[model samples]
Target: MEIDPSEVQSLYRTLAGAVVPRPIAWVSTRSEDGVDNLAPYSFFNVVSVAPPVVMFAPVDGQDGLKDTPANIRETDEFVVNVVTEPLAEAMNQTSATLPHGESEFDHAGLDRAESTTVDAPRVAKTPVAFECSLYEMIDIGASTMVLGEVEWVHVDDSVTTDDKLDVEKIDAVGRLSGSLYATTDDRFSLERPP
Candidate 1:
């Protein structure tokens, strides 16, 4: 079936559905008023490696800028927490729309760990968390792409092999369309062409 961007009734759904198995960035940020905000964004991935940069796109809500992007704008700091199978339920709980001054960490019943490089708190239960400072924010259509430079990384030893992250151990969850989600359990590797 052929589809046109202008003709598609629900472009967001169509695009999100086609993307298949997008990684979730369980972003946590602290508001200027000291409120801790946490939310999950499926439109997320690594932007660079050498300097260690990551990005996540948060689209404007009906009420305008979401708490995550707005907080990052004010503080220029955030933490990207990895969502594993065990933390999936709690991560989903954080997606609820809360009042501006409310804390999602409390809503999700999750603990916060103080970050070393940034004031933003990290998810204490997450096996991996990246403490980042805002690198840039670009307005892309209806979404704001937040680029962050990794200032510090917290990875539990259980998810590591030879001091490097082990995917099997991490057991990270991925976002599919709608309420569907996936796990990294079913994976395969192929040698790249030289």
Candidate 2:
């Protein structure tokens, strides 16, 4: 239980390395050659609200630039599709190391819909989608963290309730270490004092 990361063969598979409740980011991008790339990143979160920004880190692959980073550099646009329980299997399928020009959307048989403000397409089945333009991309050692400024948001009417996103209806999925998965059904709240 007290194993050091340097001593482990890989950090990702270790239970202690990846903290639970990691939010999923189903990123959609288009390569320079016009191939649509879709992949999931758990190292993702919203950084700001007033300006509306999100960040996700893509680890280096055997190749220098992964599809998501490359695509963002080329088009300067991307979509973050919120993953739900219904789309978990399909989302997992897109994580395969397919060829550079291969379309994960097609590979996973997921429907694609155009975004409102960005050139990139969104996953049609996702309960919520954020259309974003690249804000900044920073190289962090072995990985690159991309910051996206949200330009538009698409929410499924079914999941909207009382002017808020109904978490219970969204049934969003989260990532765990290894092949494990999680849901947002387990809930707790703490209210701040006025």
Candidate 3:
């Protein structure tokens, strides 16, 4: 089926549907007033590893500068929390469009922990969180891709295997199209060719 960019509804659905099991970045930021903001973005991934950079794209509504992007613009920092199956419902609660300066952490009954580096607070329950500083932003059509340098990483030892975090232990959740979600439980590994 040919996709028409003009039909934004179909475009959003089709594009998101085609990209199955996209990893979600549970981004937490702080407003200039010091209010906390938390939201989930499925359009996120590690774009670079040399300097450790990650990105999340927020699509603009008819009104621009949603809470997350607006807060990042003012503070230049955010924490990307890894969402696990246990935290899925709470994470989904945070995706609500609240009033400016409203705290999603409070709304979702999630505890906030102070970050060692950035001023932004991290999800206290998340097994993994990345403290990030705004590296760059790229404009693409109506969405803006926000890149951040991973200044610090917080990982639970319970999820660590040797030097890496075990996927089964972390049990991270992924976003599919519409209200569908997935977990890391269904996974297999194949050795890479050297």
Candidate 4:
């Protein structure tokens, strides 16, 4: 079946559903007035690693940019936290829409720790967090892609190995379309052939 981009709203569901197990970026950013906002976006991935850049797309509200993207545009900083099984519920809670200036961390009963390189706080219990400074924002129809350059990284000692992250220990969670979710636990190693 052929679909038209003009009716993005209609085809988005199918597209999102087929993009199985997309990584969750539990993003945290602060508003200009210091209101802390946290939300999860499944449309997130590492776009470049050489200079360490990650991107997440958040669809705009009826008026304009969503709180997270607006805040990032204001503060020029944000933190991307890797969501784990244990924090899944709390991470999901932050996605609820609240009035301007409301704190999702408080709303979700989550703790926050200061970021090393950015003013935005990181999720305290997150196994991995990347403190990023905004590099660019690209608007696509009703959505915007936020590109950030990693300025600093924080990893819980419990989830790290010899200069690498142990995914088994992290047990990161991913979005599987609609209300469904997935875990990294059922993973297999694939060796590259020369």
Lowest-sum lDDT 10-residue window in model 4: 3-12
Candidate 1 has an lDDT of 0.94
Estimate candidate 2's alpha-carbon lDDT, on a 0 to 1 scale. Answer: 0.90
- lDDT of candidate 4 over 1-194, digit per residue (tens): 77787866567788899998899999999988989999999999999999999999998999999899999999999999999999999988998989999999999999999999899999999989999999999998779999999999998889878978877778999899889999988888999999
All candidates: TM-score:
0.97, 0.92, 0.95, 0.95
For model 3 the TM-score comes to: 0.95
Winning model by lDDT: 1
Superposing every Cα of model 4 onto the true structure, what RMSD results? 1.4
lDDT of 1 by residue, 1-194 (tens): 88788876658887899898999999999989999999999999999998899999999888778999999999999999999999999999999987778899999899999999999999998999999999999999889999999999999999999999988888999999999999999989999999
Q: Tens digits of per-residue lDDT for model 3 on 155-187?
A: 989899997988778899999999999998977
Which residue pairs of candidate 1 clash?
none
Candidate 1 residue runs with Cα over 4 Å from true position = none
TM-score of 2: 0.92
Better of 1 and 2 by TM-score: 1
Instruction: For residue 55, give model 4's deviation from the true position in Å.
Output: 0.3
Which residue pairs show backbone clashes in model 4?
none
